[model samples]
Target: MTKPLTDQVVLVTGGGRGLGAAIATAFAREGARVAINYLKNKGKAEALAKDLGPNALAIKCDVRATDNVASMVREVTETLGAPTTLVHNALADYSFNGDGRDDLKTLTPDHLTSQFETAAIGGLNTIKAVRPGMEEAGFGRIITIGSNLVQNPVVPYHDYTAAKSALLALTRTAAVELGPLGITVNMVSGGLLRTTDASAGTPEAVFDMIADNTPLRRVTTPAEAADSVLFFASPWGRAVTGQNLIVDGGLVFG
Candidate 1:
């Protein structure tokens, strides 16, 4: 196929499994050196790296910890080269249970804080870690994985949705500030990805409902979501930034 990302180093946080893994593999397939960052899944990360061949590196990092993020970036830069594309796909805690999806009446500070820490703060830390290299190269692509729950608010994942909304705002703000440096920030928001560990706890009825409602009549796959992210990183999207591309099979149209 095409090697648009040839000689480029791409870091994907939380890339051991699920959506992150898909994105990492996609980057590697396109000829970018891939750094797969995982907080706990070292085995899986290493496996993915090996599968991706010589250009892939696996690094353990908790994005919530700025020091860890910095070190992870340093290692990747030293080993793989300076990262021109950073995909902030790390999530601290992800649960699909009904308990965490309560409305405002039942929302707790802990719930809000945890979500923000993972989705917003984690993204900020990852970006900060790689930004200097991107600046020096005069090119960068920051693609944050978001959720369609932020737009439609279907099942009341209040804290999660709110955190993603904050991330989207950060994406826009970063785009504006980094545009002068030829860096672009964007978000790819997907809905109810099917068969991932993160969605294992979701009720079957919920999945059924979403599939029925979505125009495509099916839940998304991690691979499908990864395509949107690849678009942002590709040369085709050089002039596109500060935008959220909803890839929910046309679930939320506006």
Candidate 2:
């Protein structure tokens, strides 16, 4: 296989499992040295790193904290070389069960704040840490993981959806701000991936409903969603910035 990302170092936040893990694996397959960051799940992260060979490193990082994110980026730079690609796939601590109990009235400020802190603020922190190194190299690719719920708010994952909506806005602004430095910012918004830990609690009926509604007539997989991230990281997406590429099997077209 041709290695398009040869000699590049990529960092993926929340990369121990689920969509994040898949994204890390994809980058590794493309010959990029990968730093897989996980808040917990050290065993899984280490195992993935071992599986991906010498070029993959597993580090624990809580994106919700700026200090942790900065430390992780520093470690990556010192050990694996400065990261030219960053995939912000972290999510706030929240379950995916859309029980309809968290509407505008029932949702608490804590919930919203926590969500924004991780998805939006964390993204900003990561971008800031990586941008300087990328600028020094004159090349960068920053991909933020968003959700299709932002486009079609039918699902009542209020906190998650709202956080991702804000994340999309941040992505656009960052793209404009970082464009002059040869860095590109983009978003990959995917629908409910079937077997991720985040989606394990979702009701079966709700999953079925989403599958039925999707033009593809099936729920998406973590691998499928990860492919979209890889696209943004690839040379093909060099000119694509400040755009949200929805990867929901045509479920929510915008």
TM-score winner: 2
Q: On a 0 to 1 TM-score scale, where does candidate 1 land against the true structure? A: 0.95
* Residues 15-87 of candidate 2: C-alpha lDDT, one tens digit per residue: 9999999999988988899999988789999999999999999999888777888899999999899998999
* lDDT per residue (tens digit) for residues 158-252 in model 1: 88888999999999999999999889999999888886778888888878888898888988889999988999888888889999999988989
**Root-mean-square deviation per candidate:** 2.2, 2.1
Residue 227: error of model 1 in Å?
A: 1.1
Q: What Cα-based lDDT does every candidate model obtain?
A: 0.88, 0.89
Where is model 1 more than 4 Å wrong at Cα? 1-3, 103-106
The pairs that clash in candidate 1 are none
Clashing pairs in 2: none
The deviation in Å at residue 55 for candidate 1 is 0.8
Off by over 4 Å in 2: 1-3
